[model samples]
Target chain A: MVKLTEEMKTAFSKVKIFPVATASKEGVPNVVPIGFCQLVDDETIWIADNFMVKSLANLEENPNVAIYVWGPETGGCFQIKGKATIISSGEKFDKMKAIVNAAKPGLPAKTLIEVMISDVFQCAPGPEAGKKLL
Target chain B: MVKLTEEMKTAFSKVKIFPVATASKEGVPNVVPIGFCQLVDDETIWIADNFMVKSLANLEENPNVAIYVWGPETGGCFQIKGKATIISSGEKFDKMKAIVNAAKPGLPAKTLIEVMISDVFQCAPGPEAGKKLL
Candidate 1:
């Protein structure tokens, strides 16, 4: 299990949108901007599936996923790669549904995606860019 | 070949950063934020490799790529999926090298990645979200 540093958590919290990427078993890639992603803990992230179609399909085919978090104002970028599990009905799903409903009423929180982070990478443009952080 | 709509072009132009996703042939995923990306044409996008390591390695193994662009102020999001070609030393590479140099001096424009867009999807949070736009 990988642990997220305090700097990484702070940067992720500041991001308004998270771009989540997933690949099918055939290697075709899909990316989507998610507005309802929360860092549940250092090693876990919860993404509320509001309108995810291709991403969900890709996840079903291949559990591997990558999430990019960047602060537009701060210019901090990080990539979190991990395995994702789709929770349709569970306590975590219920909690995520409540959060999503409170944030945007009438939207269906179909599934709550739990990502178990295995690696983290720095995405900022510099010498250490793309270097594994965890 | 696919054509980009005027709305898509405008939204992409307004984005300050582009998050690009790529997967290895084994389906391992990598994502990175790129600051030097430009739309070359309706169906082609150019990304300058400033500080890419895993992303470039993933591209070499699998050409498939996905790019996510979102406007912070307008909240417009689009996902562009395509096949990428890395140009190390060529006319396109030279041109991209010039652009990258102008944008950020001393940064290595190691390669110019040309993405041939195959599909475009709407990523806004609504009923039409995740719908095919092109």
Candidate 2:
């Protein structure tokens, strides 16, 4: 299985905020910074649904998503593309809630988004730019 | 006409890199960190395409784009949604080339993407979160 490289995981772990992209059924694109995006296993990602509005709606209409990973502490930049599953109840969802509420008391973290990463691309500007890593 | 607020413009200007979102005609979402995303006017943005591949292809297939603006110096966060027009040759394209080449000589600065801002939304978490401003 093509999973996140150690360097990519290290970069993903250090960032507190993330930019998640989604598109409506009609194809309108939306991107927003999310704070509760977490790594789950090798090819999975967990995003707590706390403040999502249009993003959630878009996801319901279209499961496709692309997440950008890069920032000050991150040594490199990458784009992770995946198919998302919205989970409102279940063991994983409950675990996500606990993690979220622990970070901020009273936070609902209403839902959990399970993203199955299918592709990873290099975003660094160079000859390897846009190269698929997985 | 709705456009970027002064505060929003200020936030957009200070960022060294930006997250730009686009989708394929098939509705698959893609997001990448772009260093050349620039504010052109009240409702326009100029992105010098020094190195864009999938992003450019996505734009060609679907003009819709979403850009996330936020960072250390930005007081707040916002998502700028727009329709992109690609220009490979033109006066504005020439101008973009000069600006891009000035920053990095010998760069191709391949194309110019002009984004016409159609909607602006709050990305901050709160009651006003996800509220459209434009």
Candidate 3:
């Protein structure tokens, strides 16, 4: 397990949207743009699923997920990969629901996906690109 | 194979960055933010490899790739999934290298990734989210 560094945390906070990717057990891949992804803690991230059908299905079949975030202003990019768990009714889910409702009203926060970070990688294009940070 | 619609083409043109995802043969997934992704034709896309390590490795093991693009201004998001072919030296590679150099100088355009789009999906959050566009 790897913890997010301060720079990684700051980069993620600056991102308004994230592109999340997941694969089926058969290796078919899917990617979607998510607007409600937030870091719950250094080692944990929560994604409020508003209208995700394929992503949820893929997660059910395979727990592994990768989320890509980039800061437009700072030109910083990072990818966080981890195992995901779906939360429908729980304290974490409730908190995520409330937060999602406050930010974007009327959308049902159908599920909260909790990702436990296993690895972090630099995504910016350079020598360090794709290098594992943790 | 699915061809891109006018709206999808326009949405991709409006994007300055793209988050591309690929999985290895073993099903390990990776996502990275790419700044040099462009649509070559309605059914073809090109991505200049400035500094991609794991993404390239994953592609070698599995040709399937998913690229996510969203327009911040129009609020349109789309995912294009296809099989990728890497071009090291060819007409396509030369064109992509010239374009990459003209757009962002000083970086080596190591490879040109050509994607033959097989499927397109709407990524916007709504009733149609995750719906296959083609």
Top candidate when judged by TM-score against the true structure: 2
| Model 3: CA > 4 A from native | none
lDDT at position B16, candidate 1: 82
Stretches off by above 4 angstroms in model 2 are none
TM-score of chain B of 3: 0.94
Q: What would the per-residue lDDT of candidate 3 be over residues A1-134, giving only the tens digit for each residue?
A: 78998878888888887888999876778888887888888999999999999889989989999987776654677788999999999898899989989988899999999999999888777898888888
Taken over the whole model, the C-alpha lDDT of each candidate is 0.87, 0.89, 0.86
State which docking tier applies to candidate 2: high
In candidate 1, chain A reaches a TM of 0.95
Candidate 2's error at B88, in angstroms? 0.4
DockQ of all candidate complexes: 0.80, 0.82, 0.76
C-alpha lDDT of residue B123 in model 3:
82
On lDDT, the leading prediction is 2
True contacts kept of 3: 0.74
Q: What is the C-alpha RMSD of each candidate to the true structure, in Å?
A: 1.5, 1.2, 1.6
Error of 1 at B14 (Å): 1.3
DockQ of 1: 0.80
- True-structure lDDT of candidate 3: 0.86
Give me the runs in candidate 1 sitting further than 4 Å from their true place: A73-75, B73-75
